[model samples]
Target: MANYIHVPDEAPAVPKIDVTVDERDYRSGALKLIKELRPSWKPSEVKVKFFTDGITNKLLGCYVGAVMQDVVLVRIYGNKTELLVDRENEVKSFRVLHAHRCAPRLYCTFNNGLCYEFLQGTALEPEHIRSQPVFRLIARQLAKYHAIHAHNGWVPQSDLWLKMGKYFALIPKYLKDPEQNTRLSTEVPSPQCLREELVWLQQSLSVLGSPVVLCHNDLLCKNIIYNQGAGNVKFIDYEYAGYNYQAYDIGNHFNEFAGLNEVDYSHYPDRAFQLQWLSSYLEAYKEHKGQGSEVTDGEVEVLYVQVNRFALASHFFWGLWALIQAKFSTIDFDFLG
Candidate 1:
């Protein structure tokens, strides 16, 4: 894995508020941070709203008065998330994307969380992303996102395989709870089987020739915020953002078409739709690089194969992540199931 570097000293430092917010009593903690950010606002008047869209972290929107203007989002890291996420890399990714006008402004970091400006848009549902214009917007935005190579001379390389290895290391050999242990043994693949799959994925995908670029890594529907009025989309949550295979990012997104709550792989985009989507992405990506926008059938075909194969890696990646989450996360979700 490439060494993760902090944002260059030239880049402005993200302010550290020096206060840790308790997830259980986030109200008081969030209020203190908000008071520092919006000192003029009366504590009684500030509205602290909990956003339920996120699964990995607790998100709270704090603002004073109506219309939800000047809102600051406080994101409390999930329990034991540091074992999986590198906070330095996350903030670095956020700063890089924000510099490119591709992301919202990040306000500051706290002891156990971070605060950022709230994006005003509706979080897309599965059906919304499947429709025309919306899908195109997502593709173009993602293409632009992949175009960013702000680490100066550092050659773009993915930590996907390295992170997978780390997640596998962290995953307990067996669940502590006997009932869950029984379910883990019966329902989930044996760790040895999973290790074999990971090795297979690494061998299979390393040869696909997918360009290494900065990727969102997790592009599930809810991560996308679409502003119908502005006719644009912004991807939030940089927890998993990093240098990765371009195809893996797109393929992971395709996997997310099944929706998070009621996963159904049947909803994955058909070949025709993928071709169209990939075509849009290629054209935009090429145009961004100052290349002609015309795309060849062969070009699309090669990417299609790479992306689909990488989709398998995406599935395997998240499965391991979920198993680890099942062991440690306080959030009530059926991670093993």
Candidate 2:
């Protein structure tokens, strides 16, 4: 909790390799990239391991030694994800976080993916995050992450509304398969209804006065890695990271309490749990900002209101994202569900 590394004055450039690795036969392409990055390691000896936890991208771990101890993670971008995500901005966010010691070292970028260091830790499950110590570590780490000012001297602005607009525009009015189209009609609100809700969200949350800060935007349990022995946590994946309303970050995390594979809002944190979590976050946030580690009940109450309201936006945003994924992604996850 006492991490004191200063954010670098300038984020160093991540070297880029001009080759794209095909997800279907990633081994050959990954080995070729590894040969360039780690010249000493023989391509034949490199162990290529595929990771399945990710829903948006194909992840591969390449290493010669023990599993995660010394490995390079090769993340193949999802199909058409470039339309949903800002790849250039994603890299900028990655480098900024790495400079602040809040992220893993980005080894390099390839034509269609990124290669980076792998954290030797357990990816948290829904039950694990609700337990002790781990939750607090998450709270503090998020606070530290929020304290990062990557704008240099410019005013921070959230891309939430803009990205939401892009997702909405990209969503197909009708799926190519009529059954999928019919399913969309029954499963979700009409496009008009969604557009109206988006408008309502923009009007409602914009006035809440939540400070804009660098937010993870996606803080699902799977994205969190907890090193039990080290007693710390690290967040992975920056595809959705950017400056956003501080409350939106916390609210999105709160929404994630329901879990992904089997969403049950009943699992959402209770008032007592949220109060404690927010209190811890505020204390850590104050300490990071050079303010004394003290938080008032009123301060917590204000944030509570803002966060819960913003949580609605989180649900809406992902719902739209999933609709797009269902139509384009090859991943087996039921995005529309």
- Which window of 10 residues has the lowest lDDT sum in candidate 1? 1-10
The residue-by-residue lDDT of candidate 2 on 40-141, one tens digit each, is 988888998888999999999999966556898999999999988888878877888888888998989999999999988999999988789988999999
Candidate 1 to truth, TM: 0.97
RMSD of each: 1.4, 3.5
Q: Candidate 1 overall Cα lDDT vs. reference?
A: 0.90
Among residues 3 or more apart in sequence or in different chains, the pairs in candidate 2 whose N, CA or C atoms overlap within 3 Å are none
Pairs that collide in candidate 1 are none
Mark the regions of model 1 whose C-alpha exceeds 4 Å error after superposition. Answer: 1-10
Q: Quote the lDDT for 3 in model 2.
A: 16
